[model samples]
Target chain A: MTVEKTKTRLNIGADPREFQKRPSWTNEDILALLDEEDGTLDPRIYTDEDLYRLEQERVFGRAWILLGHETHVPKPGDFLTTYMGEDPVILVRQKDKSLRVFLNQCPHRGMRICRTDGGNAKSFTCSYHGWAYDLGGNLINVPYESEAFCSDFNKSEWGPTHARVETYKGLVFANWDKNAPTLLEYLSDATYYMDHMLDRTPAGTEVIGGMQKWVIPCNWKFAAEQFCSDMYHAGTVSHLSGIEAGLPEGMELSDTKIPTVGYQFRAKWGGHGTGFYVGEPGMMLAIMGPKVTEYWTDSEAANRAEKHLGSAERARQLMVQHMTVFPTCSFLPGINTVRTWQPRGPHETEIWAFTVVDADAPEEVKEEYRRQTLRTFSAGGVFEQDDGENWVEIQSVLRGHQARKRRFNIQMGKGRSGVGNKDFPGSIGYVYNEEAARGLYRQWIRMMTEPSWETLGP
Target chain B: MIDEKMRAATRQGDISLEALSLQHEVEQFYYREALLLDRHEFNDWFDLLDEDIRYFMPIRTNRTRREQKKLEYTKDNEFAHFDDDLTMMRGRQRKLMSDVGWSENPASRTRHIVGNVLIEEELSASELSVVSSFIVYRNRLERQVDIFAGERLDVLRRAENELGFKIAKRTIHIDQSTILSNNLSLFF
Candidate 1:
């Protein structure tokens, strides 16, 4: 009960803006990136709180977010609790067995109705006053409905406020904006790469286990950008493991790990990027050479596993680790898992990772797939923890007023462009370039400077 | 459930240490290993690992007996985190040594106090098994200090000449479920 009065309220419904801390993004700010010299990115993106609030409204609110995989809710009455850019969202199975997503806040007093992370409940009960709703998220009961309402209370009219829930392949997507493009339309070429992730399996992909969530203190942009292209800081500022993995130690920027071990692609299609050692030059191809198969073996075994799961064509198309969905979803196709990052505040983020497995794959393989997922992406996995320290430090250091002043450049391997394999599904840049981060900033600019979907007309 | 193999080894298996001669060598070896880590002598600490050493922090989980489906630690279990192999261990050590391994930049001056070293007293001649308790306290820059106290079960195997009886594997079982607030940045 004490958490009630002090808990940060989600209802900023009508509060006048009074938090005078930092400057918001302006058109001039985005245009600066167009210049080669003065257009460098300000480190303020990592620290500024006002910029974050604006982003939540401008970018996250507009982007088509990856919610969860379709495999989660199989039959009616099932539901899973997750957050979309910090808004609690409930993914439910309707009576028709179709899946739907809604804002998890109870319509009555704006209280979060469900506390359990996931469950198979017949209806939702608001813990505060026991206002209950059926599995369809329709208000079904109140302790004293007769006494409280004057007989005209229409539960149908008070049904859940709907969110735009859709999916591209097996990956479920939701949008706060009503008129956002179809998940596939928004995905565009990004979907081409997604096919390698989703369609490759025979029975299609399903979220294998419960989501992995960890609280991180960093700007969501910082975390999201880091997921795709913070490769420039690889050996030095970040990986303590990199240093331990025999990186010459110093705090020098150059000492940081470079994405040199992999290639990077900045997709022009959906403003998303995929960075990997999936045959990109300069990578430690020798060590990863034999195990090129997404999971354990070579590409052949990978293709074979794909065929075993579904179709040969699907397996052929999608056999690499190129799955970073726009805005927030990152799928390591090779690892067969998708990570959705929910930004809570300017300094805090919660990451959710879900692995996908073939429905028809052998139980041992499914179990093996589970083990493989554990090996790396899980919170305690080597790379997972390795990246955590850096993200945390990135969040913590932005606290410095002076330290946040200098402009950080994503100019690495910039002019080394024009390297594209037209046959490939997504944009291809030189392996290990920060071009992906540049693409992120570019999309960010579009969202910030663009008009709202409502005024633009349907 | 603890693997039947590890438990049986503790009961009877490749756990003979008479060849390495009881507490003396085992105590000295573990003490030396801890010293190398605390001192940041990573390369040297690496040398102490018997070439074939299997250094692992297999996850620790809380599984209740009455659960319908007898579940053990799996990938889905919330993995607080772990490190495996000399590569990762030394990787952490190297990061700590760096000017901005910030986690330990203001290096925590530590004293690894170890005690109650005991031999399993019943295993094969080639293997030497031992158990010891430890408390390591770390004090670094402007943050709260960290300490981890726990028991270690070790299996040492004698090798050819230059490679003497060395750690075949070392598994750390903490006294408490929660790690002492510090991420285990160093090997125990």
Candidate 2:
């Protein structure tokens, strides 16, 4: 191929030219930073700029990132503009009711084809050059094409790049890597944990409100890793004040006791992970108000969930659960606050969060879930306020050269993980463990170092 | 007192002396509220709200100009930043004052600049519809500074209290769709 052809292919999201612009850090150097067995992590991983760029290309580009729900664009012409890592993409519903995600950039002049967040659009015309694309992201018209361009100039050859789309229950996910594993294969054992919220009822789930977004000056991994493996924060000190203040009338802080019976699941294949307290409702009552707690744990809604999931543990017992589907998608099951930790840079993350509810739920139950999630997990949430503070402080501290040179400890529950839990699947460990964190970093190293899907694919 | 005669006169753009005095009193009430918030007198600030006050700040969205009227802001019963009743506000106050509320433990220094005070309508003999613009500046931990500019639609009611008026309702409309601050840890 000519150099011009190669450049065109690169711009249109063909196999990225990883070998030409390789960073100084080798596979061995990246591997040395993370010691999975000893459970230690070098602080440089959170602060390095080169590593961040590699993550965007390798991890986010290959991973099946959760974009939105099916209900987000239920109609034929509906669309939602969101991000796949730093790359802007438009998720649109076609005339056949199928979903497609394509780079929002116009292939001609590289201007965004859809500037609005989301709406029904039969065709998107680029505001900069008047190049038009159909809902499927096919270039249909170029202004003065017959007059200015050669007769052989084809619109099909200049369409924006498209990503592979898939849905697990109602959640829509998109992937740019054609060679990567299918969504289910990539999710692996994580699906069992994801179903606790997404597939709790036969009616499935629907997003409650418009997305709530805010920027936190912290690494995306901090938010992703905490959701994946750090239930330890909740059981201990991080949320005590917020929980105490949110307790219902007649309930004292002293009256509540932390439940010790819970398990954390680290996905055996993928980096996905979740931790939940079994048969516990006290913490749920504090975080998600009483009405929502009742709806989630004791109401007919709970009964329906148990019947649909075919297990009482998944339906009624897993309270205040947190999970991350690898990279950036994270959510809380009972609270039903789903979010993507969109990485802005090495030191900043934009959080886009939304609540979801069972479609068949009563209006009051749905409303309660909406209200409770806002109070507990949205941008201005009492509990969420504490989390951002911790992440921001840690990121700020990493600004120091001395701070970036130190090796941090990740040895919370190193040897306690094993398989064969009856109610759960994948590698099981105690709720307050860093086993999942090890799994997450382990996967991160593999993605950062491996050049192609031949070695990385499941 | 804001009786029906005065309200009718104000509505007709007559600008009665009572109307002028009431407007001045309303503006002063806002300045006093701003002072309490800036001084970290949260309890005193709470006292200025009615027991049944609805403090709401809805999430905003980016939509096409044609759809702005319908989809620009989240509707009532939808997710919002601060959809608080009295109980919820009290809970927030408790968290703000608590020892372990790390977000506020080393409390942020803030300036609540209130301006553009407008009494939109006299809804009833005791209640008045008011609108005001604000620019809140918060500086924390040496160099972290966040400036929030927003307009508030408020319902102020005459009350037999020290402040002479209670904020019965407030709907905050922030200018940005995506909040730049890490968290809305402090009141707007």
Candidate 3:
């Protein structure tokens, strides 16, 4: 296949970093709110506007945010428009099979550079003012340039701000900070756990069923933290009813026991974390349906994955993994529902999500992956509704003054270290604990307060 | 195998009904189904489905007008909002009826405004292919209201001596790329 390369050339160009006025909150205020010692959290962290603004600048600005799967824009000149902390960005596949991510706003009047969600485009012309830009977001056309402006109105200088783009196993991520750690360095030890989803097969993964997006009234952190560490919710009533409904014919909820043997890996840096059962696939069975469960755990696919992933036991373990690659990227390994929690405001998050399946899997297996994800994890999914309800209700409650003033206890498994569990890397804890949540908040605080990657580096 | 043949024939609009009187019967059947849903009489609504029904609503993705040739949904047997056969549909009904289905504990008051019924074809003496458009207005509690508009292609089979029909298959094509509703907890 001939990849359609971009007509406009890409240079590192000028770095895109924001210089905002001093905010009302200080580093001390944020630190005091999150007491890492006792694991107490102020509710304002989910409700405060000033802190949210700081987060967009200090956290999302520097962090490597997962944009979309590379398959979404595999052909050159194919672009997917999405958001990075409320700033619209376009991820385009350039000629030479490289990717370019840039702000989607026009330099002329700040309208969107690409109006559609995803498509193959030679150039994107702003509908508002008719300003056209090449695939690399370089301003290539100005309507009636000779009649409208002087010779100094240089097209080369008016392009949209470009972000540093990187791809790890077909996942495209973009970062605005020029000095931040590379994507791999930022991923740290999280890659080992992430590989459970992306690197399970030699052909790797490709996106299926397109994007499923919806809005929820909740802080993005709530969704991120839950995916990072909250296995506690899974065992609760949040999923029990859905799991019960998905049980095999003639089998009751009491027919099987929910697995308790699982481990949560809190990242050493970057707030990335993952948790999964070692030898249980009950959740996988419930969410992904029977066809998918067989394909995922049966001999043929499992053996191939074991060889490629290089962990024979883990590959064949029938494990159901839940993971977050920091800030917003979260995915369920067996279910394969990958989503980004895009922060709309302090109290609203727009969930943009898609599912990925093994590229070389049988057509039927791929179809099952797509079908199962929609039925179990998409915007209208059974499990997704259970999760969203909790977040929405919590956000609604935080509207009260007293609710905003109370402290949320996060002291599950505090001081618990991975002393005995040598099987997994990083700080490990029981599945139903807040060890990863603490790690996430700790990293969030550090990122918000520290000015440079030098100070934030592990 | 016959369902595929029937669907292909229906899409081809190969109308074989000599008498168009059955069109009124099919329209009334759909209206009754809508009424059952609007009244939240789920078990009664469930009875309208054939035991081997394949009811589905596929997720539609956004595409430009120029890219209209590309399908909005995934390939056959791929992802969908619902891919329910009889047992799975029963499971959904059971969840909605349960007391702890949090998303629907206080069920959203729904109106499945099924209209534009067109009896497109006669697949067999017993089966008729029908097309219809619907606008479902759902309101939860005192606030959140979501409206979903879509078109449904259904395969209806003649039931016993009654003029009513049973829906053997329904493919609901929702118009919105991103569903504005929180959950598709209700049947379309």
Candidate 4:
């Protein structure tokens, strides 16, 4: 393939690209903080502003981030507004039935072109000025163009910057870097586990509800890391109270013991990770009531799902799993609370989450899933409250000078983690281990230091 | 059976002298509940609900004016911001009381403003449908203040006595499509 540098697209004074490259931290300083072999990390990685700025460029910029579900914009002219990293983006369904993701800022003055969260529109017109663009984000009109500007001014050259859009099993993803690997290649072996949520039924999945958005006073990585590798938190430190409270009436806490049989999968190359219990649905029973659990495990629905999924174990036994697709996207499989942790500076995160269910599932089953997620994972969710509290408290402590002086101990089952499991793929480990956490920071630092995908790959 | 009765009652909009009297009584009940919430009497507030109550808040969507007319909220059971039975509500209260429910540990101060009280209908001698508007302003710590405005559709049931009443069912419809607050830990 031949490559060519396109000319400057818009006439917004001194290029915004130059202004965005103003971070004052060096790669050496950041790399020194993350000791990959020893599984230790400096707290400064969570508290520094310059490091945060560099992360926006190195990590979020190159990664393939999830936009929304395909069913969210199923028809032509449908659109939804979301953020890729901190940049507000508009995901639109074009006339040809393909997807387009573009920066929401107008080229004329850098104001948002589409203001509302989402809608169907023939074209988007800037509310600040009268500049208009088609669903493809191609510039079509500028109010009073003949009288206000020179004849040499061209409308075709002033469209919003578009990202490379792709999909896997109905989930939409986009990347800003053209050189980055395809979404399939970037996903690597993580797809096997993602199928537990996205591809269980032949009819596929559809987003069940509107987005639930809320802000938390904590860094984005804290949330991402927890989802990727922290199933150990479920047994202690957090969620035990929630689990005990959610237990059935006739059963006592002593009768229901937390399951210890599970495996954690850290991706071979990318920072993706997932963990799930093997033969126990105890956590699922506590979080999602007996009705939903029965439907997910023993009902005819489970039979059909196992047939379509080609694994009885995955359909019936893989209960209450959590996963993260690196930099931002995170979700729980049985609970099905999918979210994007949009970073807002270093100390805050805006969580935009939604729920999905099999399109072919019974209405009652779908309703049960919805209700269960509302009680267990949303902003007011019981388990969600526990997880957010720890992150918020840790962030508050990171503001202290003494807190950043020591390195966090992430050495749980470090070298003892086995190579692979016969049933599961990727590098496997016991349920309670920090191997995935080490893999995450190792990938993070590599992305920050290396300039291209060729050097960053396994 | 209660779900069906509550659903039908909330859909009716009949007004009568007896209905207006019932409306007055229900309005007073709401005002008292608001005062209790503002004062942080959560345990006492818990007693105002029936043992089998269904408290729900459906997730709202931001559609164009035309699309808004189609359906402003998600389906009754499809997605809800808060869907609590009596047991779940009790659990929430228990968590808040414990020192671990950090969302409410440094508990937020809230003032629930209830207005536009309307007795939609009198479903039966023992059951009445009531609708009202509310704006809850919550302050946490020093610099955080969030205002949530919404409407409540409730089924108020008369207890054995003439003066006692309980909320059998409630459906809260938040105004903003996207909730701006950090969490919906505070009740409306």
Please give, as one word, the docking class of candidate 1.
incorrect
In model 2, the clashing pairs are none
Give a tens-digit lDDT track for model 1, residues B51-155: 566554434433334321332222332232342455444444555556655545555577788889776743565775777899987765455466768777888
* Candidate achieving the largest TM-score: 2
**Best candidate (score: lDDT):** 2
Model 2 docking tier (incorrect/acceptable/medium/high)? medium
**Residue B6 Cα positional deviation in candidate 1, in Å, after optimal superposition:** 17
Runs in model 1 lying further than 4 Å from the true structure: A1-39, A230-263, A278-301, A304-323, A360-369, A415-422, A454-458, B1-188
Instruction: Assess candidate 3 and give its TM-score to the true structure.
Output: 0.90
Candidate 2 residue-wise lDDT, A79-164, digit = tens:
99999999999999988999999999998889988888887888999999899999989999999999999989999999999999
> How far in Å is the alpha carbon of A11 misplaced in model 2?
45
Candidates sorted by lDDT, descending order?
Answer: 2, 4, 3, 1
lDDT of 3 by residue, B11-90 (tens): 54444442333555567777888888988888888888899998888767766788755745745554567777787777
TM-score of each: 0.68, 0.95, 0.90, 0.89
Ranking by TM-score: 2, 3, 4, 1
Q: Residue B93 CA error for candidate 3 (Å)?
A: 2.5
Interface RMSD of each: 5.8, 1.0, 2.0, 2.2
Return the clash pairs for model 4, or none: none
